[model samples]
Target chain A: MELFQNLAQGFAVALTLTNLLLAVSGCFLGTVIGSLPGLGPSNGVAILIPLAFTLGLDATEALVLMTSVYYGAMYGGRISSILLNIPGDEPALMTTLDGYPMARKGRPGDALVLSGVASFFGALLATIGLMLLAPILAGIAYLFGPPEYFALYLLAFCTLGGLASKNQAKSALAAAIGLGIAMIGLDNSTGLPRFTYGEIHLFDGIDFLVAIVGLFAVSEIFIFIESHGKKSAIGVTLRKVTIPIKDIIHCLPTMLRSTLVGFVAGVLPGAGASLGSFLAYMAEKSIARDKSKFGHGNPRGVAAPEAGNNAAAGGALVPMLTLGVPGSGTTAVLLALLLTLNITPGPLLFQDRPEVVWGLIAALLIANFVLLIMNVPLVRLFVSILSVPPNILLPGIMMVSFAGIYSLSGSGFDLILMILFGLLGYLCRKVGVPTVPIILGILLGNKMEDALRDAMVISNGEISYLFSSGISIGLWVAAIVGFVLPIFLRPFLKTPPRPAD
Target chain B: MTSDRIFGLAVLAVALFYLYSATAIQLGFLSDPVGSRTFPYLIGAVAALCGIYICIKPDPDPNWPAWPIIAKLAAATAVMYVFARLLKPMGFILPAAVASALLSYLISPNVKVSIIAGICLSLGLYLIFRAALGLSLSPFGDLF
Candidate 1:
């Protein structure tokens, strides 16, 4: 009843004319950003956060807009994956495994529709789950102490870092690098700079936005430059977009299953939408009667990952809202946005700032419906975005990223740092290191350190405190299982593991 | 590939430097039972270990881009670096325009089109940020 009351209150806030309009605009903008190669959901949200602030939207409204963009980007990413064989983002990478081949078979429209439907279902199911689960999770999370929280974060690291890449050591290295990046500013406990190296700007630490812009957006620019204006051969059949009733019926199970898989993965820290989609794709391939049908143009392939990743996007919000830890890179960026508005996310957020939390949930539900409606009829418009030459698009992205960052900090020094991070990001990609872990490390690093120190201080410097509670013990076991289980599962999986995106 | 191996070793070197730096951080005050250096040291050690492992056994050969592609990448980085350096002194429009135009030109070698695009994008962004959003972006001074 309380949850229903909260939901009603949330709907009341979210249904306002301004909030609804912002949601629609966010979805539209998100689609554009997401459909464009080299700019994904994270980039869209990061670029827009400052803009949203500049619009003078209150915290809840800003979040609603940003989250709508987040959902829209998820929907938009599928378009390029299906049509261009280039994934708009990491989660969409798996969509390309099946979606692209299907498109190339001259059924681009069908592929788009199937994936769109799948994304709709994924987001829908996940939102419903969030409505039911978030409050309980937050209530439970309220009881977590420093050690338990540390264990939980460690669990996230082990699960995400371990399952994400083929090589555990490499993922761990990426995580360490992220933590290193996070340690750049003044120590919260001591007030002494850890890695400032005598620079005034370094005192505040590397801005996550600067790092994300360089890592995701700027590095993408370098990639686009390397691509040298080459265009994808768009499948020209231009058939009317239609999914047969039979095909939808066939993919229904796959979509539902992947939604579940994606939601669970999204709720876990470190295991992001990419993992969810990948797992769902693999699961579908393994269970299908004709495993060979996958990757060759199976509708299920398109459906599975689309549903999984979108559902995971919703699931990813759970930990972020309930526990104040992000399950993925985009959510981490979202967390930064919330922190900017002094809206600290944690268990208390539900009680103290119910409007912001419930309003976001209500807005997201409406946004997903809007995206589903918009994507079906306007799919062609998004595909046409592919025709825009890289020259124009890249320059626009650069200007936007530059202006966004400059507006936020107004410190050109931050822009310089953004470039350095950009270069570092490019090099990391070249070397096969997963950048998500690094971003997660930076986002979670300070908090992880704080929790560890608090646990130690509580137990008078005894390491045993970290392992004392049942919750802590359970987390450690889960972490170890999360780390080791994937290696064993690797052989049974029929699909070749995608290289870390 | 030799490139990957070299990268691994380079990472090891950086990790070593990081570890050294971690040790160098002064233990300012005992604000917590475990000092700030502990986490950094752990990360440095883990990173160093990973670097060593990677160096000993690098992944399969990565396809290194040709010299031309590398040049393009370098150019892109340089353009961004210059844009950042010039952002405050020259203001947002000039550096953004130049960078955009230069980057666009690199992608498609048309000077006029690139310049027009650059100007359009800079001005458009200027209007959006300054006029629409009310964020004070300097055309030529420290905004702060």
Candidate 2:
């Protein structure tokens, strides 16, 4: 009942002309950006975060705008996948297998519509799960002691810094570096300044924004320069556009089932949307009587991954909102932003910040419609947008980035940091070290300390309290399972079981 | 052939750094129970162990960036320095446009249109953030 009332309030906020316009613009802008092969959601979010900040909306409103862009990007990614056999990002790679086939078959419009509806249904179902699960988690969270929190924070470090990347050692190295950097400020518990090294800026600690932008945005551009000098190959035909109702009905059961699969994968600490898409795609293909047609324009093939990816996006939010644990890379960036807003997301988040959470839910529901409407008719425009010459397009993006950095602050130092970080980021990618966990390490680094301190305070100086609690034990059980499941499940990954009868 | 082992050893070396720094921090008795550096110490130990394992048995890696590409990127770092050093004196639009053009050149010099696009985009940015959104352009004090 409270969820319903809160939802209604969110709707009231969402329906206002300002938010509606923002949602519509975000969706339109998102699809345009996403249609470009290399300008993925991460780049979109990184570039736009400062702009979103400059708008100075209250935290909820800012979140609403960005979340809208997120769903919009999901809608937009398929355009490139269908037109050009290249996916814009990892999550969309599954879409390309069947989507490009449909384009070759002169049914690109059907592919677009089916993908949109699948994204909507999957996101809607997962949002329902989030609405129910978040409140319950928040309620249970009220009872957690400091030691429990401390252990949970350790779990975040272990899961991300230890388990996420290919090399646990390097991940641990990144985590250590982040922790060492985090320790630069004056110690809160003790008034003694540590590691300030006589610089005023060091007293504030190294800004994760600096690390994140340097590592992600700039490095990405450098990699693009080296790897792809030509237009990211894509098709751009505005063929007859409108998928049939029967086709959508046929994919409905697949969407619902895949949503559940995606949501479950989303709940696990490390396995994110890529795993969700792989599971959903193979599951649908396995169950189909016509399994042989999967890679060759089977409509169900496109529906399954689209549904899985969108649902995973909604599902990934649950851990972040409920426990301050981010299940994926982009969400990790959002977690960092949430901290900068002075909003610590945990169990108390639901009680304290209903507007931010609920408004987001409200905005997501409306955002799907925004994406749907934008996708169905205007997809032709978005498809045509892919034709922009990379020469002009790449420079344009670089210019906008330079201007944004310049306008945000007159600080020449940040510009240097951005370029330096960009180069480092490119190197990290080349080395096969995932960038997401580093962001997660930076985001979670400080809080783990706070949780540890609280746990110590209550334990009367006994470190064993972390292992002593029932909740702590349960969390560890889950974390251990999460940590090892990926390794154990590696064999089954390529060929996920067909939907069980 | 031995780079794999060396890489693993490098990881271990990082871990040792963490362990040394983290454990070195002193936590006083009871009054300030959870003093600063306690969490860092814990993470430091975990990193050190992981590092030691890698040092003992390193995984083989085949692919590395080409030496020439790495050198070219190193040279591009000089361009970034110029962008920062000159952004204000040259005005937001001009310095930004030129800096962006140089960065785009790093992507490819064959695409002549990217530079033109860079100039137009830089000017557009001057209009949007400076003229429209009312953010202060990187101010040119006497350098202009």
Candidate 3:
């Protein structure tokens, strides 16, 4: 009953004219960005952060706009996968395995419409799950002390390295570098500067937004430049778009089961959409009557990953909202947005900012419907986006990044700092070091430090105090297991088609 | 010999430098029992250990691009640096236009199309940033 009341109040806030317009535009831009090869939801949201800030939107409006883009990108990723055999992003990689094959068999229109419906089904159910699960999770978070939070953050870093990257050492190094970067500027407890090198701009820490844009957007331009604008050819020409209702009904069960698997994967810390999609596809394949047809343009192949990845995308938001810990790379970016807006996301957020939470939930619900309605007729429009040449797109992205960063902080130093981070990101990618943990480390470093400090103060500097509680002990055990289990499991788990967020 | 080994070496050097710097932090009188330096020390140690591990067990082969591609990437990076440096002195339009043109040219060698794209992007972004978004960016810096 209270959930209904909260949801009704949410609808009232989200139905406003400005919020509606933001949601619509965000969805449109998100779809276009996501359709571009290699620019996933993380970059999509990172690129648009400057615009959101420049518009001076309030907290609810900004979150609503960004979350809409997040969902839109998940929907849009299948476009290039089916049409060009190029997964638009990492999670979309599984979609390409069967999506491109399905397109090659003709009936490209049917393949696209079926995937869209599956994405819609998966995302909608996961959003409903988030609505019910987040409140209970928040209620439980109220019981967490400083030790528990410290242990939880440790678990995040450990599992992120263990599960997401091919090399846990490199991921650990990236997290260490990120924490080192976070330690710059004036210390919160002590007034002394750590790594400022006497620059006045170093008084305040490096802005996470600058790091995000530099790493994701600017490094992308460098990659594009190296490739020399060569990959814009469309592989499959679309016939007339169709509804494909029969395929939708046939794949409904696959979508349902994949959503369950994906939601669980998404809720697990550091296990994101790529794992969800891969697991869903593997699960479906194992249970199929005829295994030979699984990867050879089977409709279920397309439907399962599409649904699983989208559901996982939705599930990643649960930890982000309820516990203030982002479950995925994109959610880490969103966490940065919330912090910039001066909103501390956690159990207190529900008590203090009901409108922001409920309104965002309502807006996501609306955006799902909007995407379903908009994607079918606008399929032709989004397909055109895949043909946008890199020459134009790269420069345009560069301009947005530069202009946006400059507009945010009228400081030249930040621009230089951004470029430095861009170089670091490029080098990390060159050496197969994952960038997501760097982001997670930067996002969580201060909070982890604060939690540790608080715990120490409470326990009079006894290290055993951190392990005294059952919850803390459990988290520590989980962290150890999460970090170690992936090494042994690596042989069994299928290697991802590409590096994931 | 491998790119991973070189990267690992670089990380090692950075971690050592960071550790040295961590030892130099001046603790305040009212600092907590854990203190600010403890976290940095822990991070430095972890990074150093990871660096050693990566160095000892580096990946077999890394697919590095050709030297020509590396040169082009470096050139593109130089343009971005210049753009950042010139953003304040020359205003948004001039620096943005020049940087966009240079970057476009780097992507493809067509000069005319690059310039046109540059002009369009700079102007289009200006309108979006200044007019539509109401951001406070001067078009021509202090020149006009």
Fnat, 2 decimals, each candidate: 0.83, 0.46, 0.88
**What are the per-residue Cα lDDT tens digits for candidate 2 across A1-501?**
887899998888888887887788888887887788777766766676666666666787777777777777777888888888767776787888888887778888899889888888887888888888878887887877766776665566556533335565555556565665666666667655556656676566666766676676667666666666343454637568876688899989999989899888776555566667777898888889978888888889989998998888788888888888876666676776677577888877787777778887888888887787778767788888888765566656655565556566666776776776677567557554567666766677666677777777777778788889799998777666655655555455554222210
Candidate 1 residue pairs in backbone clash: none
TM-score for chain A, prediction 1: 0.94
Expressed as tens digits, the lDDT of each residue in B27-137 for candidate 3 is 999878899799999999999999889889998666677898899888988998898888887899988889889888888889998999899999999998888889878
Compared with the true structure, all predictions reach lDDT values of: 0.84, 0.71, 0.87
lDDT of each residue in B40-97, candidate 2, tens digit only: 6666676566557666756566456578766657655676678777877776766767
The C-alpha interface RMSD of every prediction is 1.5, 3.2, 1.1
Q: A372-439 in candidate 1: lDDT tens per residue? A: 88888788777788677778888888888888888788888888888888788777777778777787
Against the correct fold, how does model 3 do in TM-score? Answer: 0.98
Each candidate structure's count of clashing pairs: 0, 3, 0
The segments of candidate 1 whose C-alpha lies over 4 angstroms from its true place after superposition are: A229-239, A491-501, B29-31, B140-144
Error of 3 at B89 (Å): 1.4
Give the residue spans of candidate 2 off by over 4 A: A157-174, A229-238, A402-409, A495-501, B1-6, B18-31, B55-62, B88-90, B139-142
State the TM-score of the second chain for every model: 0.88, 0.71, 0.95
lDDT of 3 by residue, A1-501 (tens): 999999999999999999999999888888888888767888889988887888989999999999999999999999988888877677888998778878888878888899999999999999999999989998988989999999999888888766667788887888898888888889888778988888889889889999999999888887777665455544888988988888789999999999999999888777788888889998998999998886678899999999999999999888889888887888889999999899998999998999999999999999999998767777889988988777888899888888888889988899989988888888888787788889888888888999999999999899999999898899999988988888888888874352111
